[model samples]
Target: MTGFEDEIRRRLLSAQDTGRIEGLLFHSTAEPIVGRLHGDGLDVLWTARDPWVSAQYIPNAGSEILLARPDDWRLKDRVAPTKHDVLYALACEMSGKECCDVEWDWDGRAKSWRVPDGWPTYGDVVGHIEDHYGYVANSNGVYYVRESAGVVMPADWQIEGQVFVALDDGLHFKDVRRSGEPDLTEREYYDGYAFEQAMAQGYDGVIINDHCQADDYGNVPHLSFGLNAIGREKVEWLALPAVRRHLDPWYSGEAILTPDLDEWLADFEMEAVHAL
Candidate 1:
């Protein structure tokens, strides 16, 4: 069960049965695997490209290698695996030690983090330990882990002090703060979030991706993403013909108003078509 050939085959079958086959890369062999790497002539067994990513066992099935068809193993540009992958994180968690240092690229610049001396090894820790400094990317890959003092940024880049979660988000640099002070900070803004800024200031560029949208912050260099709705809770609305203005007492679901209800309103002084 540990490293047996049959066990490996069984595991592969299990993956196929579970319908989790996306990046499957298996080498087929007309002959059957009976023993170790020498017996089967295959040295590698169940290994993952990265810890977080799905585990793709080496192609060793039939005589031909059955890989994920859509998968471009022969493609020119293949993604490289990182050492601080999920396995490293799990190992760190299980061993109670931090693992994997990730690298980052900012504004067409590469950034490296610095680690401290005498750090604990993967063996020293015993269970899942948390590395607070390392940032797990959207791909679940760890990067820029610095045990000494957080991620190492460029000498020219100002330290924002706060930790920013790397997601499909955009940031901006403004020249003023709400307290009417000169703002030299890297501010974050997105679609739904812009509503608050716009309501407060009467203008905003971060949410809409335009000139200074926030009247309070005024016009400034906006470094934001092309995200659709910045800060509002996105809701699914069915677009149907509206009969009148939405008059639902409670905001339960969509209110598709119709313009056919009544075109006349009764007023004490004003005459309507009904009066005529």
Candidate 2:
């Protein structure tokens, strides 16, 4: 047995019970929790809740490990798993199988696994890092309770359709050194589709999530707009360097959408609220 596998066995055996084991898996951000002996390598999966996480990693050949997503995709260049990713990892471990490899057979329902067998285990490495943890909401109406536990909600948060949280992504931030609030320019960083769509739907207010200066991507500063209604918006915006830092972190919240809001928007008031 390799040191990694030996470590996982030691911890699993030391745990008080399966429940504690589950807790360890649920709360960790960069360690492997689930394991399996596979053909190519020893597969290990991680699901941690924290500043950032890999959620899954496999010790590939030559002392290198391949990182994976909770849904079993080989994740690349990402910092952490969202709440959903952590939950998925927990659920997989509970099944006594690797999350990414097996197609779960639960009461005839079709649920996918998040981790598969084929890499080295690193659960021990993640448990040692308590600086950050991921918090995933498990139920409807559970979000309110979770807020107290570090589940952050945006200011212009709109709970929409009892299924998802919607926001205008219009919270513009003035650079602390700036003399005044910046204005929207054609070349500035903004989600034109979100702005135009909000106007078309006649929403009472369009919330701006981020309006700040960024320099990681050369000199052309950019603005970021998040329209949480359509999930596609997030998928696209996650690529922006500024948005990746400021906005993507909040995408980890529970499925919530709030409407009938009266905050952070004035010019767009006296407008109708419609779902596009």
Candidate 3:
């Protein structure tokens, strides 16, 4: 067996001693290489959680070996847009729209857009004059426009129903739905999607890089195991120095450990001592 396969076998045997061994899930392309795990009395499957395999023994296994990269996991979290993002979105909305050329009235204290005598002026107005642009509330509200531009009146200037909602601070805006989640990198997204699918079906952790692949892809070698809370507890031997030395060489630098796993590993040394 290859050195990589030998390392995987050693870890799997240790996991089996703790009763944490379940079937191994790998890409079909890796079938020939990892088929030896089956001879050790462990189940081995190459379907890698294909829907048809959902009812098979792999899904309900407490902790199965999944051949994958942790960095490829694509979980998403929601975040608020920055002030610049809101401004850019607003500018994009107004880039080429035309508005009426209105006049501005200076009341000594502040200057405001003055609609034509017969024009209805009840809502907010946002426009640019020559090279300057800004937002102005109704006649009774505040004006934040910059100096000098051909003022144009928007017949029905309304922004509330669109992409942005003015924040309580009045000067800032956020997404109307406030549900804008940043997109994940393509590989991360698909990886996360597949991991989630496996988790939903009851698998608890992944054994990364247990298969053979060319090393020219520029990905740092990450040969660690990643476990959810339950899997970590079940496969505690994974924390051993002997096991970790084989896995940790490129883990921190290249693998994107999930927040939960990161926290668990941070405190695991103490936890393991206490368990002893």
Candidate 4:
């Protein structure tokens, strides 16, 4: 019935069949919450996937709506409830809901229902802005994708024709950015944890993942070094690119694989080569 609720009703409810409506709840919370609703049991949930999402929830009346990880106690934050009927009606009129059956008048009453009964019918308002912060491999270095997207502002790095893709939080890559290309400020890129790990292992830049083997998910193959990871904080300056020490079809495909870093980096070489 309010301005924000009216806007949310126009956006999210129709996205039910689209699988994970991007902005379904949690506008002013610490993190961005997104979710979907089930019409069967009227079950619903919302969450923050950035900054390392975990299964969690908490209970309180801070807001009329509850946001949390599905089937978990780790709640993100309390969000105000929206008029689901308003959004639902808009959704049905615009895009048919194939995900679940919805009833604008589920209670059999004309929006005159009281609390507890009407509470279950309300939806939560999610914001359109999203924050993406993480480490993605660049050739010899990494691209720290630490930026947020909103209606008024454009994202700094994205997956279009741009070099940086909005990969998830826990993903890795071979050096996607090359050295001497341009932009070497820490604010643009963070000093990779992979380089730091190699230094922590007394190898210091000797064990970078320029030509390292990786899984289809962009994760380092058999890699447990826990290096080159990213946090929520933005990179203060661009970091130096990592050293190449392997051979493959990836960016630093001409480097050699080290015995210490790539004991089996050679095994995945055939697969990488076969692709080319």
Model 4, 1-276: lDDT tens digits are 344433433333333334342332210122222331111121111122210111012111112211221212312332222354332332232233322322345655343322222222112211211222122334433222222231121223321110010112233323323243333232112334434443355431121112222222232221111112231121111111112222233443232212221222333455559889
TM-score of 3: 0.18
On TM-score, the leading prediction is: 3
State the lDDT of candidate 3 residue by residue for 1-276, as single tens digits. 344433434444444355342333222111123212221112212122111111121111122121111121221211111232322223334443212342334533213233222321111112231123333343443343321122222322211110000011111111111123322222221244444444555564433332222222223222223333333233212111110101223333422222222343446546658889
Q: Of models 1 and 2, which has the larger TM-score?
A: 2
The lowest-lDDT stretch of 10 consecutive residues in candidate 4 is 51-60
**Candidates by TM-score, descending order:** 3, 2, 4, 1
What ranges in model 2 sit over 4 Å off? 1-86, 94-181, 189-210, 213-276
Q: Which candidate has the top score in lDDT? A: 3
What are the per-residue Cα lDDT tens digits for candidate 1 across 1-276?
123323333433443356342222222122234442121111111111111111011111112211121122322321122343433333334445442353666543225433334333332221112233222322332232222133232212221111111111122212222333323353332234443444345321122222232212334332222212221112111111111122332343422211210111112114534467
Clashes of each: 45, 40, 5, 28
Q: What lDDT does model 2 reach?
A: 0.25
Candidate 3 clash pair list: 74-192, 100-152, 102-151, 129-149, 129-150
